[model samples]
Target: MNLKNKIVTVIGLGNSGVNAANLLSDAGAVVRATDSQDTPATREAQAALEKRNIKVEIGGHTENFIKGSRLIVVSPGVKESSVALQWAKEHHITIISELELGFRFSKGRIIAVTGTNGKSTVTTLIGEILKSGGKDTVVCGNIGNSLCQEIARIKDDTWVVIEVSSFQLERIEKFRPEIALILNITDDHMDRYNNFNDYFSVKSKIFRNQTADDILILNYDAPYLRDLKKKTRSNVIFYSKKEGSSDAYVKDGWVTCVSEGKIRRIARISDIRLKGAHNLENVLASAIAGLRAGVREDSIGRTVKNFIGLEHRFETVDTIDGVEYVDDSKGTTVDSTCRALESCDRPVILIAGGRDKLSDYTVIRGILRERVRQVILIGEAKERIRSSLDGTVESIFADTMPQAVELAGRFAKGGEIVLLSPMCSSFDMFRDYKHRGEVFKEAVKKLKTRRVPI
Candidate 1:
């Protein structure tokens, strides 16, 4: 793992790529960073890399640089079909993800969480539980800060809780976590993957390098994970909302964990602040990981009670004229949007549609027909969504977020909810999900100023 004098090329120049380049440069490796687009963020990242004496190639990628390097580190955003990556493969150059690079140098034991949804919530909760138990914890990856950036801060006793994505998992070689949790995998990232099985295979790699001494937390109810006991050598632990054979499950209104014949109450269902059954699954998974990390049950329970949930994931914007507005911009997949729809108690005027992930929107047809009053569509997938939900629910097309909000507000009745739970990625319009959520909130604020009639 000695990087001194080694030639390294980092692709995509995003946060993770820049961090990887800087890390390699700091370790005396010759680093070259590349990206296709010269965005403001890319420029800032370029400047940082330049300050570290790392070479940067922006606006486009060069295959020669990647092929000639001793190693290539790819950002999660970089696709497998990239010409430079293809060249690197043909040349037999060692290519690894930023996460893998970080793991090679990280001093702490890793707790990695991966799923189509709920990775952030579960990862954050695990970090909180460990911290509450007076353990030094660092939470990173996919959620925001790159693991490579956090590598320098890792100490022997530190607990590194990571939120991993399938994209990052695809390129990992030996990035095995001491504790791995696969919350639940559904049809997601279909645009990137050829099919559902292809996506699942990539995600299942999180357990590939795990040994019998390591632990894997799985969803007992998810059919995909139920029979995966023989897939890895790790000791598998199960968490379920239903009363089933699992390490963690709700029993008599309390979430309990049973490991090695020892039973412990993690938290009461009424104590968790996060809404929805999906969140209950998240809590259960986190609690199991927390307990395995030696966190006290009281510490885990207290963290769950105080955890208010993440932004853009069922966050309440404001109520205007007895109508509630919820921003679930993180609901970028059909399964995630279905969870959001199911969580709402009141009738919904749903604002949905964005860049389609090749998702089957019909999966949520039953919920839409039963609960949603109307579906206001926006972005690239609007027509696809409208077509799939044409007879199931009333659908309207809007060109912008403001228009969508206004239209939803107009149709919303008193005690109704105007929810922005687009079942596709926000890349069709905004920079990402966070920007999309912010714009939706701003639109809601504008509605208040207009005094729009309900």
Candidate 2:
């Protein structure tokens, strides 16, 4: 952990990569960074790092750099089996994530949230509640600023709220959160892990090192996580959208968290700002973390009332000629898009298809057929998605986002919804889900209104 001119090599020049390299350099570490892509995102990052005297290798991994470094810091997106990482392992050099490094310097209590979905929403909501309670808080990790950049200057009383992913958790050692929350675990990132169990184990490690004094919060409704609760040694506080099973329960449109026979209730579900049942799960998890952090009941209710949703996750784009358009670009998995469909009360013209995440699309197929009036497919996995849900719903293929939006606009009737909720990834057609959502919104805005048959 000593930063007295240590030679630290950063792998993958992505968002966390560039930020980590900068942080290490700022801490007086001799930093060298590498990435596979030299695209605009990476190139712009490389130029910025160059101004700070950091060395970067783009388009390929350099074995010499890995062998020569005293320590290697990896970005979350890169897999453990990546060539540079394997090289470092063979050379017996220590490899760690930015989160691990951040923990080494962080002074405040860490409230970490990890799951397949809704982690960002829960993390943000918990931060808001703590801040409203007059606590010094920084919402970092996958949602806000990187922890490596934020943790260094935070005061002792500050709260570090992080939305960690399975990728981040895979590399963490001794990075324990005071309140560890597992929102829900579904089949996501199967391509990253050896299997579903491997992914689940990595996520469960968030509470693996925690003591009895630390809090472990889980979604009791999720079968996978509910089963995990029985295995973990940490004291658990369970939450659910249904009644009777969880320590925190939502019944008759209100959410109540019961701990040690003390009940704290949020008056009405309608008062919660974020949309969808998925968001209700987020609110419950956040409330549990807030209570664990000793946030006042009044502050928890007030913050829940004021907390809005995250971008590209069921964001309403526009309504043209009474047809609603929604962008849920953050829904890059089958489970996420399924919740998006469940959130709608009206029939939908769903836009889906992107790079395959090795996810079985059948789970959402029945929901789509029952709730969606039509589907416009785009991106790399269009054919696979159509193949998976053949004859269940009306499907159309479009290579471009504008064309998909145009077709959806044509099929959308008044009072019906048009949604862009690709149940896969955005690597095929856009930079990421944000760019994909922005393009979908722009295309919907350009839709011309015309009289259509109901």
Highest-scoring model, TM-score? 1
Give the alpha carbon lDDT tens digit for every residue of 1-454 in model 2: 6775889999988778887888888789999999977788788888999899998878888788788789888999998779999999999988889888888878888999998888878888888899898899999998868898885668899999998988888788888888899887888887787788898888888998898888898888887777776787778888888887777789777878876578778647888768788888888888877877888777798889887787888989888888889999999889988999999999999999999888888888779878998988998889988988998998989989999998988898999999888988898889888999999988876674333344
- Per model, state how many residue pairs clash: 0, 0
Compared to the true structure, candidate 2 yields what TM-score? Answer: 0.95
lDDT of 2: 0.86
Instruction: Give the distance in Å from residue 135's predicted Cα in candidate 1 to where it truly belongs.
Output: 0.7
Worst 10 residues of 2 by lDDT: 445-454
Instruction: Superpose all Cα atoms of candidate 2 onto the true structure and report the RMSD in Å to 1 decimal.
Output: 2.3
What is each predicted model's overall lDDT from 0 to 1? 0.91, 0.86
lDDT of 2 at 426: 92
Root-mean-square deviation of every model: 1.5, 2.3
Report how far off residue 402 is in candidate 1 (Å). Answer: 1.1
Candidate 2: regions farther than 4 A off: 448-454
Report the alpha-carbon TM-score of model 1 versus the true structure: 0.97
Pairs of residues at least 3 apart in sequence or in different chains that clash in candidate 1? none
